[model samples]
Structures are given as structure tokens and as C-alpha cells.
Target: MVLMLGFVTIVAAALAAGYLLGRLRPWRRAGDWAADQVRFTGAWVRGGVVRQAVVVLVHVVTAPRTSWRIMRTPAADTTAPVPVRDPDWVAHRTRADKGGTP
Candidate 1:
């Protein structure tokens, strides 16, 4: 009977741990998503014709001339952009998507 109780307790703990980790998955991804957005925005702001020209000039002026290897890599077709929507808009959209009148 005590062995059965021990087994039940272990099963309960495993289930509780699984539930907590499942709940944490979204929060972990949210942090990563926010970081990606910030990096993308920073890169967008930094990238411009002027920056490109400066980079070109620096490369040209450097003494050791290096041959650029232009590799034609296939574009990423799998990853989709994360949709940014207001909480209220999301709630409405969720309801609308479910065929409920929002």
C-alpha cells in the first residue's frame, strides 16, 4: 500500500511539473519574440544608404584587399512573422475567428 502511495505521489508531482512547464513555454517564447523585435527595429534603423556607403568606403580603403564571396543561399521560407495586435483586438479577433459575435 505504501509503495502504491509513493507511485501515486510521484505521478502527481510529474503531472504538476509538466503543467507548470507547459504554462511557462509561452512566457519563454514571449521574451524571445520581444528581443527579436527590438533587434529587428535596431537593425532597420541602422541600415541605410549612408551606412552602406561608409561600409563600402572603409572596405575599399583597407590595405589588405579581400575577395568577397557572394554565396547564393536560399531564402528562409519556413518562419512566419509574429503578429502584433492589441489585447482588445486579439480578443475580438479570437471571438470573430471562432464565429462568435464580438
Candidate 2:
């Protein structure tokens, strides 16, 4: 148990020393470099997450049922109105059909 404790203490000291050395390193000294790295890394991850959400949203808008036709691309039909299902009526009809009535 004493040997294990000594080993743990040595490892912790080494890690702390290494961390201090990295902080004092010449390349890590520039405030702008650190700021730029932080900004760039943060922007990369943030943009990735936002980009994913945009892709999903765009896909949802472009889905067949949504009929949210794209203005970026050519329209599928110039005159056909987009479908907007009435949920209450649809549910009522579904119940009637299930009871063997149209």
C-alpha cells in the first residue's frame, strides 16, 4: 500500500511538472495563438453541430410530405397546392374505416 501510494504521488508530480512546462513553453506563450486555437477548435465543433442541424432541417423541409418546395431549385409543380392534412378529420375517418365503414 505504501509502494502504491509512492507510485501515485510520483505520477501526479510528473503530470503537474509536465503541465507547468507546457504552459511555459515558447510556442504556447502567445496569447493570440492560444486565443486563435481556442476560437478555431470551438468554431470547428460548433459549426459541425450547427451544420448537422442545418442539414437535418433542410432535409426535413425537402421531404415529400412536407412539400416545402425549394426556392434554390426548380419547382416540381407550378400550380399544384402543397398538402396540409387535417389531423382531426383524418383520425375520424381512420376510426370509421376501422369499424368497417368508409
Candidate 3:
């Protein structure tokens, strides 16, 4: 039980230290570089097949709805016209409030 507790403590301390170090700018940049390198290596290994598959998958998921919206004509408007105040109403109010002629 004591040995297990010690091991857990050591792991917790290591994780905390790693988290702190990862928050530093240099460490963060290094991590990003490593991640990019890994991604590049993965893409190189998979060749064009994975890239084409990803494109096809994205198109299959998104193209139908977007293409339909773009190609389809809009429905005709049938709603009643919205009521709006006359443009001269504000000018009349301002003149009346300033003691000018109605």
C-alpha cells in the first residue's frame, strides 16, 4: 500500500511538472513542431489516397445540402407588406417640437 501510494505521488508530480513545462512558450512551440512533423509523416506514409479520401468524405457530407441551396430557385413571396412610417414624419415632429409651423 505504501509503495502504491509513493508511485501515485511520483506520477502526479511528474504530470504536474509536465503540464507546467508544456505551458512555457518554448515547450509549446516544440510541441507544435513535433505535432506538425508527425502529421506530415503520416500524410507522406498514406500518400494521396488519404488526402483524396478526406476530400471525398467532406464533399459527401457537405455538398448535397449546399449544392441544393445554391441550385434551387427561391419561393415567391406571398406575405403581406410590412407597415412603415412615412419618411416625412420625423421631419414634421422635429419642426413641431422646435415651435416651427406644423
TM-score of each: 0.32, 0.26, 0.26
Task: Looking at model 2, report the run of 10 residues with the lowest lDDT sum.
Answer: 62-71
Q: Give the TM-score of candidate 3.
A: 0.26
lDDT of 1 at 17: 92
Global local distance difference test of model 2 = 0.57
Candidate 3 has its poorest 10 consecutive residues by lDDT at 30-39
lDDT of each: 0.57, 0.57, 0.60
For model 2, residues 23-51, the per-residue Cα lDDT tens digits are 88754344334334333545434667775
Error of 2 at 28 (Å): 7.7
lDDT of 1 by residue, 8-68 (tens): 9999999999998898886556445444433355652476877545444443334123313
| Steric clash pairs (candidate 1) | none
Error of 1 at 61 (Å): 39
Better structure of 1 and 3 per lDDT: 3
Q: How many clashes show up per model? A: 0, 0, 0
Top lDDT: which candidate number?
A: 3
